[model samples]
Target chain A: MAAADKVDPIHQFQIHPIIPLHIGGYDVSFTNSSLFMVATIVLASAFLYMSTASRALIPGRLQSVSEMAYEFVGNMLRDAAGKQGMQFFPLVFSLFMFVLVANLIGLFPYFFTVTSHIIVTFTLAILVIGTVVVYGFAKHGFGFLKLFVPHGVPGYLLPLVVAIEIISFVSRPVSLSVRLFANMLAGHITLKVFSGFVVSLSAFGAVGIAGSVLPLAMAVALSALELLVAFLQAYVFAVLTCMYLNDALHPSH
Target chain B: MFVTSAYAQEAAPAAAEGDTHAGTAVPAAEHEAFPPFDAKTFPSQILWLVITFGLFYLFLKRVVMPRLGGIIDVRNDRITQDLDHAARLKGEADAAVAAYEQELAEAKVNANKIGQQANDAAKAQAEGTRKKLEAELEKKLGEAEASIASIKAKAMKEVGTIAEDTTSAIVEALVGGKTDKSEIAAAVKSASR
Candidate 1:
């Protein structure tokens, strides 16, 4: 690449090994991504531990936040998966807090975004779909396959309708994983690009320095938007997981 | 080893390198060398993700969720108990009010009954007094009528005596004067009849 092209926007996503380890010729080295994941877990644990340690009748601010998060997921699960689906409250709550903390951690400058990677998001998506499948089969036996068939379809269109339903059902994980991954990736890239413009233009004469304000403003705005997107994506992930679990518990429709 | 310096260096070579060369002198490198897209790191990422997520799930299920649910349950129980206590107090108040009103009504009735009894007793006593006075007056009138009858009889007897005397005297003056008392009395008796 030319020297001007060395200001690579995509370079921000590089995963360098902090502690290189090789096990059975498979590289399971602890990288920046792992560091951020660990950070997310630690931070989440601290928040939960401190907030709930008191268990006060009249909650303080941190306790209120903790309870709000709990009830938010609780209500979502109840609304989407019905009362019976509260059994998965732990899993859904964990996922929401993990993703939310991970995304928020990424907002800090130079911090690695664990959710921006496809592997992490894809694994979470797989876990969700796996739970749905395993529980659906266990709960309903072969009747779970009926999920691919609509109830009120005409006789002639049954096969085609079932095929479409099966395709959409299979696409759930892909859509779920890609939605979070792509959103995080795109938001980071946009932010990096705008910041790059600020740096590149500031290197010019006084005119260039004055013009750099526009990209800086754009970067600021994008950062705010990314923060909102971070929260929204986490919420969407949890809600969709609940919906899929609902399908598992009740596969008739 | 310093991550911040390394990240800064990686992010902006234009500012760090200070406009070293013109456009096309450097080699054309792969711009798409994004580490997240690299398939090699997938295994490590997935491994740590599973481990961390598993630990998190266990922590939440075992420790955090139960505590939160318990706190909420306790608050709800306290609220219900308070409501029941309030309802019991309200029922007590209503009963007390009802009892007070009943007592007030009974007292009013009692007052009216006492007044009626007192008025009836006074009326009976006055009626007895009036009847006693009427009996006394009737007795006095009877005695007075008996005395007047006796006086009238006495006065008639006196007048009859005087009339006999006067008749005897007149006979003496006019004729020879020897009148018998039995004959004079018999004449007075016949004249008075």
Candidate 2:
């Protein structure tokens, strides 16, 4: 198809079924997104296994990296949620590793970015928010509602502040999901657009080929920036999750 | 520019035809409006996500995380044990040094006492020898003085006898009679004094 040949920047994000299957009239087909997700799991599991296998007192490079990751997330939780928050280390660590690995793997050429999809990012965001709300309610009962009400607010300003707090609280999943999804989507699109410019211009003549250099350079720069963004977005997601959990644990503000 | 623009325009119609063909290939209704925006694929994505995430969570909780935690715990315990062992060794070394110092001090005290005893013994020995030598010298001097006194007495008696004899002979020769021996002795003694 000519559409397939034409450089569609959005084409890279298309979810084609690798194993088309239907279950109960639902399209439960295994897609490229699913494949990459499984790949992420395998990669993450392998890394974790290799790093922890030796368990040396004097850590090797891989073990040190693994330990640093552990402590990095550990410290983030401790700062945001205190000692009591350590109980959720498994969940928080899982989120951090999964997101970080997914983001990193997506950086590879021709790889699908799972986190770039709103559905996927939204699911993760929902999971985080869900955990916070469920645990908050379970732990604090109705006092979890106090999270919407800040201390030291004047009576007249209380309603407006409370409304604003409630709105922001309700929109946590949206903002969290959009932050990651938009970053990846925008970065990937920019990279694709620049790369497409190079291709399109090169098809034109000698002058076009020389002009393509600028876009090629831009693509290279964008890729490096995307790598940084990939790490930063994952970190932001984890940190925000930790903050949300902290709020749940201490519902006073 | 003209050739590139013409090529792009030609590609556009072909792309539109390609889209129609692709649309029909998959059921038109089932076609993803936009792949990411398609609601039809949400269920499958969510379903797989849940399954994968759930399995991953369990794996991390049961296998990976626990192993990591155990490794950290073991390393910490080892570090603590090593520190404790080092402290114990240091304490032992300190005790040994203290004991050595105490023994050294005791030996010094004993050495000093022995030196003092030797000096006193040597002084007493020298004093005894000096006293013995002085007594012997005094006895010899007393004997010599007694002998000299006796000799002097004998010489004085002889001198008196000779003086009486000589006086008697001179008196005879000079037609004078000799005086008594006792009287001559008294006269000689009176003259000598």
Model 2 chain B poorest ten-residue lDDT run: B19-28
TM-score of each: 0.84, 0.84
Q: How far is A215's C-alpha from truth in model 2 (Å)? A: 1.3
Q: How does model 1 score by TM-score? A: 0.84
Which DockQ-derived CAPRI band holds candidate 1? acceptable
Of all native A–B interface contacts, model 1 reproduces a fraction of: 0.64
The per-model lDDT (C-alpha) reads 0.86, 0.83
True contacts kept of each: 0.64, 0.55
Off by over 4 Å in 2: A1-6, B1-32, B87-106, B128-190
- DockQ by candidate, in order: 0.34, 0.38
- Return the clash pairs for model 1, or none: A1-B27, A1-B28, A1-B29
